[model samples]
Target: MLCIEVLVEEPSAEAALKSLLPKLLGSRARHKIINFGSKSKLLKVLGQRLAAYAARINKGENLRIIVLVDRDQDDCQDLKNKLEVIAVQAGLTTKSNPDAQGQFMVVNRIVIEELESWFIGDIQALRRSFSSLPSISPTSSPFRNPDNGGSWEALHRFLKKHGIYKSSYPKIEAARKIASQMNINENRSPSFQCFKAGIEALLSQENENLN
Candidate 1:
């Protein structure tokens, strides 16, 4: 079984990803994420800290440990540090090009921090993407079981909860909400499938318009 380990700061984001990431990536298990309470990055954390965390996992060698980020609160430099810390701590072997003073195959994501402002740059969306769970409602459950319906539905629900879908009319998330409200989940939420799809669609549309 393929496995993915994720270190994130937003519970909702993790939940959103959990709903459809496995399906989208054809993963065997949902990506396991670690959302630290105080906003520590991969670099801020120590090797011992990472060892402690990674050791507490069920997934083995065929695992992809990815850290999803929003990068709202962290500076770019800060984000870089955090990613470095992740590899140093996870006990994942890294080959050092001692001459250049850098290690090879260090895992992390710095794109989120840069995309934070464009994505939402707010508390609700930030928390959702980073692994912070606000008060969940009775109508919506946060735990995602792909075996049930996959992430297509769960991510749609999350967008509504955080107001990401409603705020932008005719946007991907908004379109998804409309489709979901009408019970359409056969192929990627009728809009794109997941947030990632919506993003891709928008980018492609923009590129087409540019050309």
Candidate 2:
């Protein structure tokens, strides 16, 4: 079995991915999501962790690592390149640098702005999670481009306008709720699709290896 180890930026992303991965990978694939509390913490230990994994892989461990983090103010490609560099420095090959059969050990994903962008991508899932939410078209402006600076605040205001969760945006709870209803087959967020595509490609490779 293929073991996909996911490194996420925070507990909310961990919660969200935990809820979504099973639906995406099915019962066959084994996966784990690890959170580092913040981006700084993640980058701090990432190199060492990847190095350890590289050693284990040399010992015949069937493992793959996927790193996910919010893009925030950083350049998306730059962040991805940085992660790939870290992986390479730890003696691991990335999708950007694959072996003879194009096999890569690490996949890095950047969530544009924030993970809230994904929630904004599938407003219908939010509506399903919170029935009181007003009907929202997928083409709505805020939903169309969720990379706004204050995405969480914007989402909070939008939900508050509908008279739901007026106090604050419960990050973990909201993530889990929305993820439960997320349509993995379709999402408007480019970042989310990139994440999904990475998982699918890994799964496809796993299947080929089994065959």
Among all candidates shown, the one with the greatest lDDT: 2
RMSD of each: 14.3, 1.2
Model 2 off-target regions past 4 Å? none
The most accurate candidate by TM-score is 2
Please provide, for model 1 over 43-78, each residue's C-alpha lDDT reduced to its tens digit, 9 standing for 90 to 100.
355456556545643243444355445455457467
Query: Per-residue lDDT for 1-211 in model 2, tens only?
Result: 8899999989899889988999888976899999999999999999999999999999999999899999988987899889989999999987777778898888888898899889888877988999987788766768867665567778888898888888888999989889989998777888899889989888888788899
Pairs in steric clash, model 2: none
Count clashing pairs, candidate 1: 21
Number of clashes recorded per candidate: 21, 0
